[model samples]
Target: MPVDFGPPRVDPFEQAIELGAGRVRRLRSVPSGPAAPAPVQVRLPRQRAGNCTTAPVRRRPVRRPGVPSAAVASEVARRVSDRRPAPRLRLTRRGRALVRTVVLVALAIAAIAIAVSSRADDVTPVSSRSMVVTEHDTLWTIAEEASPSRPRSETMAKIRELNHMPDATVHVGQRLLLPAP
Candidate 1:
């Protein structure tokens, strides 16, 4: 047997009876002898486009014997209007680029501000006294005279650093800068 990939065919008579094609269900009311109210048409919901098979139709609840029709109609209206579609945000390509550029600029400005705010402000003051080398004056004697309370080695290193001297060699009449006492 060949395989079939289509919806099963439904019998027309059975489908009609299932949809209550010839039926008129009336709400219970005082019966008038000669004339009866016209039957209300039951409209089935429309199927989506391109749909091949029929979907099940939902039936409305049967009104109770003593309930008023107006109340039922109001309840249905409230339910139908309860929910609404949420608002959506749609950005075009140019809008997205503009937002990206704004964010990058903001980041750059923030970085620059942080860099400017966090800077070093404590600068060591330059204060020194100049001295002329004399005959028989050695670096040790000069260090001892410059800082009597400090270590001789520390004072000697500081003197050498202040004068940019590589060693303890000094000539007579040569001028040298000494660190503050």
Candidate 2:
């Protein structure tokens, strides 16, 4: 191997200028005075070699066998920026389970809230009247007398449920709350 002590790589612009390849011309004259800052005269190439068009040349990305160009560009950008991809929101099994549980709880709470609100809208004030049990007054007799138009079985069930009576038996002089007639 030859010992190389020069710059690691040659500048393409300087190489072009030395080779007189593009017929580069200065756009403006450089100022020689110290009053203002040094003027940077940009020398633009007249025409690219082997191409006659003045329009900018667009370079196509090299296509690898199985790799896509977009992926390559994204990788290049990431490397150039010296930043790791925003740590992919990776979830472990426990993390996924926690997230799922939270979602389920939220859904359950929402469902409960909806059900409660809907039930609230349907609720009306129930006005109940009290009746004292007599010797002849049984549950069936009271239900029949209170709501004669309604079914006896339904009225009796409601009365038993209201009084928390496991069996259809009422002591004499016992106070009972009857549903609306």
Candidate 3:
């Protein structure tokens, strides 16, 4: 088996010098009529990108197959800086304005509906009665006088429900709003 060694290098200058010196020594011993043709210097044409006359647009090598990782990392960092809220969907200006207007109008509608409903309940019915209390007027006596057909306790309860009174006490000349008999 043979072991392989590295390649051997060759120098044209050494070969030419050796050949010329050998010829000179030989000519000293036996002179020649004419010297052989001298070694001609040859140059190799170097292939280079700079030498291209009409160079094509060289495209940059793709570092990734999909979106770049650096951009993704930057976006994630920006979101995390604000405590990593849920990823927000993108919206155009017109779409954002539309959403804002819709929310505002909905709130206004809710407020209006609440106000109208409250006012609807505030309208006093014609069947209800109001009495001005004289001196020594009590809620029980008034309930009995106001509703002779109904029970005194029941009338008092109805009066309390209507006038929002927690007790049966009444001040002198205090106008009391009573419910229907």
Candidate 4:
């Protein structure tokens, strides 16, 4: 089977209508009445390159009681005499001293608390009971016998430190100081 395609056609009538409509619109827009009025003439003052002219400003005269017209300048001067620059803010000697005192007091309070806690921890009570080692006696058995209230590990550490034992081994007839609970 073979496919068939139609041929394209260009129309001249549509182009002729568009050109005629544009000509008619241009002819109808031409002026149909009298001309407009002429603009008014305005002259501006000539300004020098160095001189600038400002708008006229009027200021009311300041009147003061018992003052002559010539004294107006002095009166204005007296009115603005008290307008001084603002004072700068700076810490005074007394203010600095107060701040230092506050810091010192805070540090003293912290130091006192630390000292009291350290002293309390250093004052571990020593036990009154002592143990005498015999043959084949272990530190574990001595700790159990001397300070039964304390944990076994704590009692062993105390016994080790008090007797200054190099090892866990103990000879016969050795004395061991027991620490308090």
Best-matching candidate per lDDT: 2
Candidate 1's C-alpha runs over 4 A off are: 1-124
Which residue pairs overlap in candidate 3's backbone? none
Instruction: Report the alpha-carbon TM-score of model 4 versus the true structure.
Output: 0.31
Q: lDDT by residue for model 4 over 95-178, one digit each (tens)?
A: 989999999999999999999999999986766867778987888888888778888888898888877888878877877777
Better of 3 and 4 by lDDT: 3
> Scored by Cα lDDT, where does model 3 land?
0.68
Q: Can you write out model 2's per-residue Cα lDDT over 48-136, one digit (the tens) per residue?
A: 56777556543444577877688678999888899657777989999999999999999999999999999999975454787999988
Error of 2 at 4 (Å): 87
Number of the top candidate by TM-score? 3
2 versus 4: better lDDT goes to: 2
**What shift in Å separates residue 18 of candidate 2 from its native position after superposition?**
66
Model 1: worst 10 consecutive residues (lDDT sum): 10-19
- Give one digit per residue, the lDDT tens place, for model 1 in 21-127: 33543343544557654434333334455773765444454777877688678999998899788779889999999999999999999998877766533433444
Error of 3 at 136 (Å): 4.1
Q: Compute the lDDT for candidate 2.
A: 0.73
Q: Point out where model 4 deviates above 4 Å.
A: 1-121
Predictions in order: lDDT: 0.71, 0.73, 0.68, 0.66
